[model samples]
Target: MSLHEQLYQWTASQGLDATSARRLRALSGVDDPPGDPWTPLRRGAGALAAGLIGFGLILWVAANWDDFGRAMRFGLLQAALAISLIAAAALRPWRAPLALAAFLTLGGLLAFFGQTYQTGADPWQLFALWAALGLPIAWASRSDLAWTPWALVVATGIGLWMETFGGHSWRFDASTVPVHAIGFVAYGLLCAGLALRPGAASQPWAWRLAVLASVIAISGTALGGLIARDVAPQFYLGLGVMGVGLVLAWRHSEVYAMSALALSVDTLLVVGLARWMSKERLDVGGYFLIALVACGLLAGSVTLILGRLRDAEARA
Candidate 1:
């Protein structure tokens, strides 16, 4: 081949053929490749902005905490926390479900009990908060991940909160029983629905969520006992067992991870509060000790498996 022809052929082999280069240039006019070169800075800026907003809100709440009753202050704190976590969750790059979980779980935990801690807030106040907060949570995001557990926890928390304030009457005739019952049933149903649907409480804890529903279903009498101390103290034991099981199964699912708290509160109420009520007949050492051992082992195993699954999911 002539030297000039050889030079032209070599240029073609180098991928700088004018036609191909022209095509690439044309594509750029319409599409900007796979990613934005400036995305990281923007994301960082957004994250920083969120952090600042959250920190400022918290500081403002703290400054005003004294103006509210202990309970109201805590309630406000909870509402803020739920909103902030949700805001952060919305801004997250991935796994919005975890954020949903945070908002739902924390929102439920704080908002429900926030009333008891408040000296002045009525029983209906928390309900109002639930109605208020739950509406937005259920509405604002299309995310089931955060809201499902959020709703469930809120339901259970409210159920118990109402029962606590209602004073364990178990009159069954009182307005409290039926009102709390309907609410609990709805909350439980919502939680179960969220769990049953896809992408909410994925495996390991999926069973855990299912287990929580079962615990509630079985705790019918115990739920009553919370209001009036009507049933056997054994009710507390059952309540504790369920709490321990839930904690073992889903404690890792939460930030504060107070599966132990439920167990502690219920068991204390069962053994301590009930004891204080009158006769103080506290036996069952042998039975609960065995249950304690068995439950501890179960919780540990579930935790290990859940951690592994979370890791696997992250890797995948």
Candidate 2:
């Protein structure tokens, strides 16, 4: 536990008066050496600048596509990629932003290649390749500034692959196998994020993004099952995975994960109830009932999560 937390616990346990506790806190020097307030602003500015530069490069290429020959286009992208990578290696402080530039340039290069050659490959293939190639940059940067974007790229690739291979239908058929594949992929990402060392700069945001993607994927598949003629296996599997995730997150005192899982459960419950009501000739009373149940669930979930947070803070 942190020093401030220990001090608070000690004071509470000892039943110290307000003045005495204040004196003890002052003596502890926990409040000494105020940190730089500009750090967050600087980081945010750097990330924004990098994003703008990457996006501007893409737009410039697109706008001048007719003017530039094939060689010029490829040369421009390749040159940008090389320059970004070289600068990242040379400048330690600018590593994350430069790596991000390289990651974006790599994507642009692959996209131009596919367009130029007419590879006839699916869009997901391009994104997958981009993600695979960018993994090294993310690993080298060791920052969420890189990992978060990589995670997003991976999620987009998975979604596109699902759309291309799984089709739009949610029915329990051979084509829907890709839905289960996606669930497995989501679970894999969640597990990998959880396994990372928690003390790293990238850990918290990376894991949170993984959990978010997992929750969205599972919830979407499970909801689709509600519309299927026969229940899909993904429905049961997704619920089971969510149950396990909830238990693991609770054990680790991850309130964000718990809240996300609980919200998903609440959504499924409310939607399922509404579907059942529609089947039974639902009326105004039924609508009111659904609204009431939703409200209750929301309230209960909020209370439970807040209580858990309080308990965790007290323990800390």
Candidate 3:
């Protein structure tokens, strides 16, 4: 059908008045949306291919791990790292992907060497070394992908360090309360640095990962305190860190920062309610009333936050 006939039929089917129909036709007649969306898709596909190649190399090493002698294994890993680095340098615009591959391959080499030599070094030592070694590559690449892995490496090192000294597994407990508090505060500071530093404007992943890590640490410590019913001093430290983060987020007018702050606040409220419930004896009716109140509070809080977010978006 002709373009005008199609528009007429569409407007007639929708029962639109002449004025609205005219407006719609005028809007539709404007130039098509700008920019090449395929650019991102191509970049994403390239990164994915690089990641798959890296993972495939790891799998190959794993499959043939027992078959190779120590010298052979070391040679193979070193060769892989060298190849990836060379490819990264030669790949021009795809340098980020190959650089990331080389960075990850270095970790694999470290892990293999540690296993082969049976080093008595703590697990954190390996991760710390990995992060330290990767730092130069991340700086050279200046890619968010490189920064993401760097953040994860640092977080893993801190977590392993906490677990070893705090005498706790991955879970939070009285023994690990201080560790969680320290992690929460440290990561929150790191996030603030990432967000505010003059040199970090290009590294978007830094703030995102830092904020996520801080939230996890804060929520873990807070919830662990509620579960243990200890309410230790470290729990207060977490709260203090969260308060700082909240204020920073508000001052900066950042969406993710605000969301993370809201989440931590909600966690504190929920934990407090749980602790209070543990101390009280409630009949069925009383329990129902408490539940209703909690629900109402949650709903109201969510609505208010969402409205504020809308306002912020509009201003932006």
Whole-model Cα lDDT per candidate?
Answer: 0.50, 0.79, 0.75
Model 3 per-residue lDDT tens digits across residues 1-316: 8878888889999999989887768766633567799977876876798799988988998899889988998999899889988877887788888888888889989998899899999999999899888888777776766777878788777768877777746554556666666766567656665566544775576668877876876666665665664666555666677777777766666667777777777667766775677687867876776677667766765676677776776565
lDDT string for model 2 (1-316, tens) is 9998999999999999999898778777787898788966776777888899988988898899899998998999999999999999999988888888888888889988998999999988898999889989988987777877788788777767776667643455546866666645655664465457444533567667877887887788777776576656666666666777777777777788899998888887888788777788888999999999999999998898888877876576
- Model 1 regions more than 4 Å off: 1-52, 60-124, 131-133, 138-140, 144-149, 168-184, 196-198, 201-316
Q: What would the TM-scores of all predictions be?
A: 0.36, 0.84, 0.79
For residue 293, give model 1's deviation from the true position in Å.
Answer: 9.8
Using TM-score as the yardstick, the better of models 1 and 2 is: 2
**What clash count does candidate 1 reach?**
10
Ranking by lDDT: 2, 3, 1
Weakest lDDT window of 10 consecutive positions for candidate 2: 194-203
Q: What RMSD, rounded to one decimal, does every model reach?
A: 16.3, 4.6, 5.7
Candidate 3 wrong stretches, greater than 4 Å: 1-35, 168-181, 196-203, 300-304, 307-316
Top lDDT model: 2
Off by over 4 Å in 2: 1-33, 168-182, 194-203, 229-231
Weakest 10 consecutive residues of candidate 1 by summed lDDT = 255-264
Evaluated against the true structure, the overall lDDT of model 2 is 0.79
Residue 173 local lDDT, model 3? 55
In candidate 1, what are the lDDT values of residues 123-183, reduced to their tens digit? Answer: 5555556545654544444444344454545555555555565564433334454544554
